[model samples]
Target: MVAAYRFKPVVVVLLLALLLLASLLSLALGPVAIPLDDTLRVLLQRMTAAELPADQVLIIEQIRMPRTLMGLLVGATLALTGAAMQGLFRNPLADPGLIGVSSGAALGAALVIVLGGTLLAQLPTAVLPYVTVMGAFLGGVATTWLVYRLGQSVQGTSVASMLLAGIAIAAISGAVIGLLSYLADDAMLRTLTFWNMGTLGGASYERVAVLALCCALVWWRLPRQASALNALLLGESEARHLGVDVERVKRELVLLTALGVGACVAVAGLIGFVGLVVPHLVRLLLGADHRRVLPASMLLGAGLLLLADVVARLVVSPAELPIGIITAVLGAPFFLALLLRAQRRGGV
Candidate 1:
């Protein structure tokens, strides 16, 4: 552990460098395929007001830049929340969806996609695009709140109860989403299917700003709970003995996770696996310390998502695969391997 601690700084630095390279690739790769130098030139010119080719400027500034930024924010938010959730649950396999926010958000987005034509017709055209985003965000928060309430009792918030409630809520939400999918028209069905798979294609400055704010709040606040999270790994009763406010920590972590994951789902649809996989990878290198895990997960998640997006773009050329599909392809095998390894070790 001491040796691992000594290498944590180096690991973080390497992850940061990888993230920087991934960001550059995200900006440069696509159907158009801007050269790395031109991508850098366009980025620098944006800051310094220097001249560049208008088309390159338009592509980088208007399209890829926002997409890249969104990828970073979404990836970091999901992975950070995942790390927090695992710490809260004292389980390595726990993820943000363990709280039901992802399913609730999906249900909400499904409603908007299937029903927006008539139900949202009265809304201004300018505001129509965001109705789904808002709905998903609100739905996620509402479900999390309901789960939190269900977990409450005379004994205070029970982590075991919350976990069960979250599973139940997620099931209910999934059922509702299935119903909506059944009712959707063919056009709506296609849209809903794509959205469910997730995309960064909807990236816009406005949406990125909203997500960035949520990510900022998460990044600022979650790390402050690092000590509490560390205590939590010792078990809640042990955490309380260590003077950690176990219930309050649980409440805050749940709320923060909802906000971060909700915003990502709202904007990018249902990209998965980042929250479940990235933190575990970080822990493999840096130990289980939240201080190292959280930050390292952030860097790695952002980088990995960006690389996945690059693959999504290149694999189909002019058309692109949904990023969620790419992540699922990558994560499922790793997840299975982890489970198998754990079983062999009698840890599962």
Candidate 2:
């Protein structure tokens, strides 16, 4: 296929190398500024049973490491989810945030946080996390299904309809969130405020482990659909004629995207644009083929977020900014540029 010509081995290698470099730099360039050599030494020290200075070991082991890893997981997950969502919808503009999936997840999470006291008081602390996450996942699935349905009729999926539905869903979701905020007391309101802002400041070993597991599951599942997604781009009827299971593919992509994204949102709140922008960039540079788009988007997405997280930390210095702000600053310009370019080319 002409599309697969750009899938160079070197591109994947370079992306991976960049991701590794960003991860290490993230570990080194924090407020305390752990040296690269010391960072390596401490990481190996823990793995190889060697001794290092107590404070340095603590910094690498406890603080920067978890945060860096969390950034990687969150970035990769959002990108993967984004790529899959775009492919499923056959629109480069599709994204978890743009299509109201994140809003739904946020609504679910907000409900959990605001009502946990009265409604969920009897639930065990251990199950509370899963409850919120499941709520968010269900919300994503529901919104995605609704959007997909609305976007489809006797004809193919209508990008315009999907976009409009997303706007309506976002408006309704925001109204619901505002209602939840109104009902919330000061403490719950504060929690909701932070969740809305979105940060990775709470990263820890335990959370990273869960994020890793969910991300791994998504990575495993998404690539398997690459060929099917390729067939899908030919249109649902054509794909079905070619023996592709259109319904199954849609269901799988929706659920998998929702599951991974919901977990990430449940953990890190709503971080936007990574999904919308990264996949388009991947397709632009590499190819439109889902085989290339999906994996590259994941890697580049991780690298982009890590770079953003780094900027988020360094821009405000010791008083680190929330990552969502950093992404907005970066993504907004790129988005506008994309739109302008598409407009110049007679519009997307």
Number of the top-ranking candidate, with lDDT as the measure? 1
* Model 2 misplaced regions, further than 4 Å: 1-7, 47-51, 119-124
Superposed on all Cα atoms, the candidates' RMSDs to the truth, in angstroms, are 2.8, 2.3
The C-alpha lDDT values of all candidates are 0.86, 0.83
Output the lDDT of residue 112, model 1.
77
Candidate 2: lDDT over CA atoms?
0.83
Instruction: Return the TM-score for each candidate structure.
Output: 0.90, 0.93
TM-score of 1: 0.90
List ranges where model 1 is wrong by over 4 Å: 46-52, 115-119, 125-131, 145-169
User: lDDT by residue for model 2 over 246-313, one digit each (tens)?
Assistant: 98888888888878887788778888899989998888778888888888988999998998888888
What lDDT is reached at residue 136 by model 2? 77
RMSD of 1: 2.8
Single out the weakest 10-residue window by summed lDDT for candidate 2.
43-52
